[model samples]
Target: MKLSFLGQSYEASNPAIAATDTGETLTFRGKSYSQKQFNVALRQPTEELTYRGVRYHR
Candidate 1:
């Protein structure tokens, strides 16, 4: 379940998007991703995300 996010590459396991009073944020492992630059990864996936100008897929 390799995924491509933005345009860069990364490895994610059981990734999840967490939203609070601030905004939306992608969290996985021990890292947190808040859409900034374009990035992608090849490993595993828990979901497919595509919103506004952000894109995450396998």
Candidate 2:
């Protein structure tokens, strides 16, 4: 999956869910997510992900 925020982009394959001081996040592909959006993304299906006009899949 690929996610972009604040002009920064991150890609993760089989990302892992984690909890942070603020809320939940995901850690994958060397990036750590501490944003609510990332937590919501965890519920997304693995079949497809669209970020920054690009599509990703497992």
Candidate 3:
């Protein structure tokens, strides 16, 4: 899935927050995101699931 956070875009096969299968870090837009960022992103009301084109919280 493709998602945008903090003005950056990321692609992931799984969208679940803090998924261990995805490894310890998530790389997006040439940057690596740590668990804290992942948690923050998951908590954000704006986080979206690009495949479904809907906000994750809603």
TM-scores, all models, native as reference = 0.19, 0.21, 0.23
Model 1, span 1-58: residue lDDT tens: 5667799677546545443444568888989977444334445655688879898865
Once fitted onto the true fold, the runs of candidate 2 whose alpha carbons sit more than 4 angstroms away are 1-22, 37-58
**Candidate 1 weakest ten by summed lDDT:** 35-44
The per-model lDDT (C-alpha) reads: 0.63, 0.67, 0.58
lDDT (tens digit, per residue) of candidate 3 on 1-58: 7999999887754445653434468789999876543332243355545556654542
- Candidate achieving the largest TM-score: 3
Q: Write the per-residue lDDT of candidate 2 for residues 1-58, one digit (tens) a residue.
A: 8999899887866646654465768898999967553242254555677879999984
Clashes of 3: 0
Error of 2 at 1 (Å): 31
Whole-model lDDT, candidate 3?
0.58
**Candidate 3 has what TM-score?**
0.23
